[model samples]
Target: MTQPPPPPPNQPPDPQGGFGAPTPQQPEPGYGYPQQQQQQQQPTEPGYGYPQGAPPVPQPPVPPQQPPYGYPTQPQQPQQPQQYGYPAQPQQPQPYGGYQQPQQPPYGYPTQPQQPPYGYPTQPQQPYGGYQQPALTPSAPGGGKLSAQLQIVIAAVVAVAVIIGVGIWYAGSGGDGKDDEAKGTGGTTQGATGGGGNGAGGIGGGGKEKPPANTQAKMAFQVPQPKVPDVTDVSGSWITDKAYVKPGVNSIVAYDLDKGTPLWTLPLTGQVCGASRHVSADNKVPILFEATKRVAPRYYQQCTEIGLVDLNTGKLVWSTSITGGSAGDQKARFSEVTLSGTTVAAGGTDGGAAFDLANGNPRWKPQVNDENCYDMGYGGGAGLVAVRKCGPYSSQYVLVQNLNPTTGAPVSQYKMPTGVKYASVVSTKPLVVAADVGETAGDGSGISDFFSLDEKTGKLKAKITADADQYAARCRSTRVEACSQALVGNGRLYVPTEEHEGSSGEYGDETNEVIAFDLTTGRTVPEKADAGDKYTLVPLRMDGGNLIAYKAPPYDKGGQIVSIDGGTMKSTVLLENPADKSVRDAETSFSLNGAELAYEGGRFFLSETLVSKAREGDDRNYLIVSFAAGH
Candidate 1:
């Protein structure tokens, strides 16, 4: 949703400013942490992140979501899952000491009075493992130092903790699954993601877009949202040297990167359901779409077509589909798509298939078997990995397999820990997986720990325990490569901490920071990028060794695109959007959960992936809103 800078250590907490300032919360339970909240369940069979108490309706299996801020300006729809996007699992309110009202959506709900605007804010106390020791903020201005006796007591406690930690590591190495508690050199290594953007030394090298002379951007053009009767999915966006590409109702369209005018449009017979983020060296991507649009009675068309689109030419080079298994003669329908090197792959409940990226040549077809171990999904970036699920629907575990892109065979396989219903692949080469072991992250954020494994050997290197409340990184429960705000590069796993009270200001500001964990040591590095007060930072993607991030604006400001040094965590604003009121309101309206963002060549684009019919009198809904600096 955004980008951020570190503030001075000690400042007064503002009683105002920032979006969605959360009141202090009682420590919450996560993946492996102890539960302090209680709940209830329905008698119906459970599906991944299914609506808790609703009448059952057929839908795709989706991940859970933590509480998300809704659109205040747009008309308020019922608090239900849209036809697209993840579903928020129902949580029963637990009895506390006092009565608690149900949570409210942002639109139409009465907002609390506005507080004064604050400046720089403080860092959030990072949560360690699950214990959540109090993060000691710097003493407020002029605060006195600790006394000598107190210092000595703190030292003794630290010494005892070190000794106990070492004992746990030793005992954990001996098995009994206690190893889950130990820190890890996650993934053991890191490699460049397979696009030309990862130039040597992590520079956005290779004639890639360079920072503009003036980083301030004025309003460019926007793609208006097409009205849809039902919630629709246009969930893909990308950029190249010449154009910005997006998928619309039943076509893939490209627009002039600077002018925002249409470059060309490639028409298709049906709607686009999914697309691969990785663009091949030739500027081609494989997208999954339905064979035809709704034709009444059979309103929901199956996603049965895979078409390779040439971004440079805006043409559909070839299209293909497979048929077998349960569907018999009907083409197989897939829910996911990814790319690695020269191979394009698609996976789903029906089966999985791989095709040559250059031509529609089948490399492999679904094999008949009773193993029940299907490749549920694959992650593509620096490497190709598959999350293979086995056992019956009642009880199933997964295997993370590093696959040969062309052969579809496992080069190395790592067994995920027990009791993990689903695992999200964060990276493939260094091979990191995120999961909520035993459903410990009960708030529906979908992750509590990150497992770093050796991609070549499939051996475990380290396990990183991150509290769901403390970190904002999320990987959709089953969609590999569906991770937002979680970035990996430079041999490190980077994540933004959840927003907290800022360091200084008349009205305390809300802010967050980006921190790195060593991919080899599973230890945190000193590098961190703070989201300055009044804005929030979300990791967009990596630019060579540097990180490309978006700085989500507050009420009065437009968004920003920043480039951060991987080693120093120093952020350079590459593109600062207009601060004008109209533009700022338009830019901030897109929700973080449903928005698709891309920044390249001084152009920053924010688009809504899920759209529905807007009510009369409401501001125009946007499909793609853009800004360009030095264009």
Candidate 2:
């Protein structure tokens, strides 16, 4: 037998395994079909199973068929084999013009039709003239490996997108975009770990325990006196670093707290009737009412001057003179003046006046009705001036109004309780109105009621009633009658009281007590008095949750400073002032020569006037002392 010849170039090999076997009929042109094989020639050389010079077997001729549409008559050139095996069978042109492998088996074995890979097409594919297949990517078990540079770029893009999203969220959430440290005043600095330190002081009646009392006199300084004679009254405001002194009948001077140096002095051309400190954010000034005596034939006349002097520079900012009859008759001479923000309001029995603080121009004329008398003053922390109008008869109602700080217009107005003749504002933040509630007794003593109003709407919050006899007595000794001896702190009002003696004609038989009332519920706090404590505990102010009180003597003598716990009512002496001969001599000559206590920041201040024995004729000097420990 002879070996088979190789197939013609550009033609496919037979799919059938038999020698010189006829192939099946193919489909017409343009239809998808496998390429046909050409006739093979006999082998010239001998093969392993065949001898030489064997007769050649004739192959049957294939019928002529037209070529597929759009294809040339000649067959295409065969491509190189992808793998080392028998010559590859010609493939049909795919629909996208890519080639597909033939459906044929290896030599000598029965031919079995090929199946496409799973998920691929089983039928023959058609030609698609300009289409190309995408190249397959090399991959591992999971997926293809990415380049290092591409991975870094993807991570950077994702991180940037996250940062942008976070930035947008933070801006929408009320971030002020300022450093936290730059937003505070730094005034109330607290201690490191202690609970009852400066800034650690809580409000609303809840706070930490009081610290141990180590209030020995830490230091002392003197506020120098003006050389003028007849120094009538001296008062101090610890909110500012200055003290006010009224010397003689016409001069008011302000002195520095640290060095006893005079800062400014206001000399009135007329006799000074009354003066007060008007505190504002931009400037602190003294408001004065002065009366100049004008002598006319047979009758004496007088004119009043209302003036404001800058405390820092001693400059007379503004002054206006009003003839006695034009301003408020004789009542204008004694009108109460109060400062709230940039408005200055003066109200009296006759009328009232509101002035702009910037230039002292009149904002509005005083409202005076013949049947009612009005009194105006500061409303404390609510940034308002209270105008209280009382009727002529005690049976009529009293009207109260809280005026706007800048406009002097009534923001809220309400009538006093029945049978109340007078109402005055005591505190402003938790607005407290103090008024005489009922008729006086035979001894001229009465009951005073304190009503706490809502700061914004002036609605009543709480009401507490207290005895007015001791309050009246305490106010009579002070220069300013409107100054509330009752201290408001830690959500309680601490009022000084005295037990009235029976009808036995005994003046020195009264015992003093300080009562604390809760502002929220208007109930008395259940606290016991300090054991064996005889002296009156007069509360001046609150330091944290503790009360800074003065132990007043029964007679006109010296006193000591003490700290009273708000929760326990325990008393601890902070300063001890002996009633020696020198102090008694000073008190005998100068009635105002006693210890005055003030506290600011974290330090305690005490101002005392001592008689100068070296000088003649009632000469006195002032001494200011400070006490600061664990501040």
lDDT of each: 0.62, 0.41
* Winning model by TM-score: 1
Worst 10 residues of 2 by lDDT: 169-178
What is candidate 1's lDDT per residue for 576-599, written digit by digit as tens? 888787887678767664578888
Q: In model 2, how large is the Cα lDDT of residue 154?
A: 59
Q: How do all models score by TM-score?
A: 0.72, 0.52
lDDT of 1: 0.62
